[model samples]
Target: MTEFDAATAIGEGGTAELSDGWVIGEAVNGGILMSLATRAAAEALGAAGSHTDPVAFSTTFLAAAQPGPARVESQILRTGRSFSTAEVTISQGETATLRHTATFADLDANSEPVHLQEAPPELPDPESCAPAARGGFAEKIRILDRLDMRIDPATVGWAVGQPANDGEMRAWIRFADGREPDVLSLPFFLDALPPVTFTFGALGWAPTIAFSGHVRSRPAPGWLRMRITTRNVIGGLFEEDAVIWDSRDRVVAQSRQLAGVRMPSAPVSP
Candidate 1:
């Protein structure tokens, strides 16, 4: 099997480079980019270990990426006792691709627990679903090939897929083409539940304004179910909140992102 360990260092400095195997498509997606940035930031901070979990990240897509050699540069803005902040610029060849910032913090005990407003969508047993893997690139966006998923529709309630990797996970994902997913693609997986709360009309086509995620604990290897909802939609901007649950149905991580309905054709400001 082709090997692409997120823990491995691809490169570092004001600029860095990394490599990933080609999946259904030549380009990378949100999750891979996030992992690259997270790894770069953790390495830069001299963090005790590979980011066991991601706390928060904000990425902007400047251009689409093609599979092959890639590079990432993580800039440490500040390091504090409780928290650290950094920025990452990802690119391929000479063209700049994506830039984003991230914040990491050590978990503390004093953090108060919050009440649960809603439960996650139930999913089918991952084993029941058939594995779908094709050799070449897919015509439409599909992330099923990279994972093991089961979709009984009526019985499962929703899609339940897990990555073949050791510990990392992504959940609540379907294919862009509406066909059963081919692999667990990162972008759509991370974005799936966030916009569910918004009436389809309220979620106008918009670019991501910002994204943030917090690591609660090291997630177990299994199909994690995620529930996403639109928290607020106002002033042409919307915020989506994501809650990820493990196989046992325990919340593991939470993420939030903001986007605006109207975006200029020009680059987004930092």
Candidate 2:
């Protein structure tokens, strides 16, 4: 099993171990926490039922998680013919660190046509871009070792002290361990990239208050392309919207997050 598979695996009664390998800074990556909870939820649904694939997931980060043993708790909210709802929580000992809720269904049975969908953003070949985890942010994000993330050069001004101030970023991402993207890995991919606020030079400890991700389809195997954008940054808060396109350019996942941030500093009068 890959490191990701190992870290996300829960044995017995939802017991799991959060690894230091996925740390973003001092805390474990929020997406990793989501992955752990999602696994527990999927397991709860079990192989006996058709409602096994996660269609949507939402999580609230109550506190930062550190590398250590954590417990996962899952509750089946409702099981229906078309959809099933579940609640999962990741806690360290007696302290709860994150709470999650998700909806599941058999994706294979979902062949409905798309009424409206956005085309994938145009990007250079994965090899043509620069690694996403570099420069100032590199020092803070340790998860880079496990991911092959290449950022579009045009969107990498922030790393070179020339932040675009446009609140956007695009990148090509995949596992450094060569594990292919699948339904279970979608949550991680959605939240794995550097924050969009980095485009404005606000790389300070911007904590995600809440995150929601929707899985539209199972991704085709190959490198995934990602585009993250923000339309507003106000009142010390920013919202980031992300979309992931699979190898075939199909939109596989979409996510939005709200987080507290420190806006770029203005000139100080001498």
Candidate 3:
């Protein structure tokens, strides 16, 4: 099995052990945790004779998850000829860490197509952009080394003390191991970008409260182009919206998340 499949593997009774290699400072990356849940949900659907693929997934992070054994309990909420829905809860011992709901469907190949949106945002070629600089924060979190990310120079002024008027960040991202994009990997890509909050002078970690994303279509091979934007920050909370476009220039997924704005001096919840 591939490294991803092994990391996300579910055993008898829907249990899995998260590997320490996937941990970031004190907790496993939220995206990696969500991907495990998504994989378990898909496996449940398939075992029930449903051939559909996950098209949408939403998850709420209720607690931090350490690198250890966890259980993924899934239930099929509904199943029809065209689509299915499932709920998955990932827990360690008896405490739930993440809960997710997913909708799966078989994509129609002969359906009529309509294009309403324009092309994706323009940015310098990935080869021309430099890899994102790893600061002290990254030194403490080794998980950042597992991703190959190149950020648009114009969008990184905040790193040098110049905050952008609008909180926006654009980058090209892919696994450092060169794994091709897939439905399960999409969650990781969506959550992998440096928080848009950084562009607006919020430098500390932005812990996600809730995240929702939709997979419009299967991704084409190659690096993903992504854009993340934050419109407002109020009372130490903010919302981040993101779009992921594949190498073909087609939007494969989009996501929005609500996260707490944590500062260096602020107290963090366990």
Candidate 4:
């Protein structure tokens, strides 16, 4: 098992080069790229004397990133006594790949807990579900090798040319290396699953336009259960909402993204 390292050395003028490993299809995974940018932003905030975790992160994808080296440029937007905001841009040479803005703050650990939302979607035990198929698609996307995913069999009809009546997917996911998840891993896991459009009988890639995630709390050590749903797909565009529940069944993070739905194309030869 290989562990994912999101480390970056603080460079002059808020610059750092991202390490390669995570990739999907012809591009690096969006979640991993977002994590890189977030790390650079966090480092910038710490340098400015602000120590806080990212509470809200929003990103807009300008272009797809390829494996190998990329540079991240971070700019501090504002720093308050309790919160800080920063923007990070990742570029490969002259081409800009991703831009992200994040807000950071120290959450109050002693705050009283309030419960209002209903329980997460019920699914069969992780052990009972089938592992995600890792054939042509997985081979093209090398990042699947780094994840341990057990998806609900019912949600996988699309894989066999059957469309799901409802656009919903459920899976239990964790790092293949078994590392405990943290705030930094939250965004990566949030976007780790396949696009919800697949369940709706939409083939081909659904490239994300913009994505945002809110980190509510760090996950406990164990598999992260995820439920992804799409309420609409129209005009070659769609919206996906993802909810992540920790081992303790607590909602740890929430994410939503807008993506362009491309029509299914002929299979590519490896």
Candidate 5:
């Protein structure tokens, strides 16, 4: 099995383990947690082949999920000839980690004409971009080590106390374990980067409260380039948006998230 599959595999009784390799700070990455729940959702819906792709999902991080065994409970909500939906939840013992509602459909069969006003960001090749800045808050996110990540140096000013204050970031990423990104991994990749708020001078723990995303197409093998931009910051809360593009330049996914953040003056969360 691929690293992602193993990290998110569901066992008997809908049991699964959150791997430390995907850890960010003291908890498993929220995206990985969503993956576990989505996998279970797909299973509960008996999704397979072209019909197995989780086309869209909206999840709420109820509590921090530590690395270890967890259980996924999937309740099928609807099943039709074209799509299936499920409500999935992950729990570690008595604590609820997250709840995800997802819809599965056949991406291969969606041949409708594409009309997109959003364009892909023009970024330097992964080989030319700088590797993930290694210091300060960025260094502490362990999941960065599990992926081959390269950031545009221009957006990394926040890493060195000279943030551009633009609330934007662009980067290239792919699994370090050689796992090619597929439809199921799009949501994980959408949340893979550091909070874009870093570019606007807020550089501490930014725990996501809600995340919603859609997988537009299956990704092609190779590095995926992504752009993240903040929508607005209202007091201590902010909303961020992200878009991912495959190696072939196809729009793979898009996401929006709302998280509570520690603006620059506050100490990092423990």
Candidate 6:
């Protein structure tokens, strides 16, 4: 593995800030922003990846952050032989945006049994979905104009013009200027979409409280396909479970998140 500049930014006050490229809904994607903060946390603790060592990461999104310049700070919770734990906080202006906890671990050989539990659903070709025409990450954060997206028609493909990660959402992501897609390259996958969930009348916008994932496998580059569907929304909280697949129908990484609905701006459980 090679070292790359963290997708997230370091805070002037020792906190990580949101990338100017990250925008979501009325605000930036807190999940992605928080994920980067966790990465910064790992780097601060000297647990980041190197040419020979790769680290697994898990993160939590504690609050919804408005769009603006932001910052993040991390604390090393603990370090063990196989894994290290860290906590991070994200801020916009002065108000706290999100808090995250993460774990980084070096890979090791184990004789445990392996299993493939889930697979992507058969969906239309990415070209078949409706295309969004949003511009850069600044104007439209949630709007994707890259790959085709169909919430109702629902299949697996990319959401071009959005974050691109080999997952449940096939996003047409262009790298920064001269950057190329690689393992070390930061993949900007939108882990959360609040408006879609709110439009369903199930619950409106809910700030993400936390996000966590275990690295089961790494992905290959090129345009990828991602599929996501809301499974449950209740008690002022909603959950999204997603699956990611590559061009060859290969299952990539899997991720899930839980968010809290704050009403009006969000949804009431009634």
Clashes of 3: 0
Flag clash pairs in model 4.
none
Could you give the candidate ranking by lDDT, starting with the highest? Answer: 2, 5, 3, 4, 1, 6
**Candidates' TM-scores?**
0.61, 0.95, 0.92, 0.90, 0.93, 0.66
Q: Which ten residues in a row have the lowest lDDT in candidate 6?
A: 158-167
lDDT of 1 by residue, 1-270 (tens): 122233124644434333333233445545556656766676767654322224566777777666656777777887776677778787888977778777766534212263552455655555544333334423323434444433233322212232111112223433323333111123234653313322332222345556666655434455656655564556667676777665555566677777666422332222
lDDT of 4 by residue, 1-270 (tens): 236654334456655555445777778889988877887889889888894588889999999987666778888999987778999999888999989999888745511284554377788998899887888767776777888988899898988899674779999999887777877788888899888878766767778999999887667888889999987766778789999988888788899999998634532111
Clashes of 2: 0
RMSD of 1: 9.5
lDDT of each: 0.50, 0.86, 0.83, 0.81, 0.85, 0.48
Candidate 1 lDDT: 0.50
Better of 2 and 5 by TM-score: 2
Give each model's clash number.
14, 0, 0, 0, 0, 31
Q: In candidate 3, what residue range of length 10 has the lowest lDDT sum?
A: 109-118
Ten consecutive residues with minimal summed lDDT in candidate 5?
261-270
What's the TM for model 1?
Answer: 0.61
For candidate 4, give the lDDT: 0.81
Please name the candidate that would achieve the greatest TM-score relative to the true structure. Answer: 2
lDDT for 88 (candidate 4): 93
In candidate 5, what are the lDDT values of residues 227-259, reduced to their tens digit? 999867777898989999888788889999999
Residue pairs in clash, model 3: none
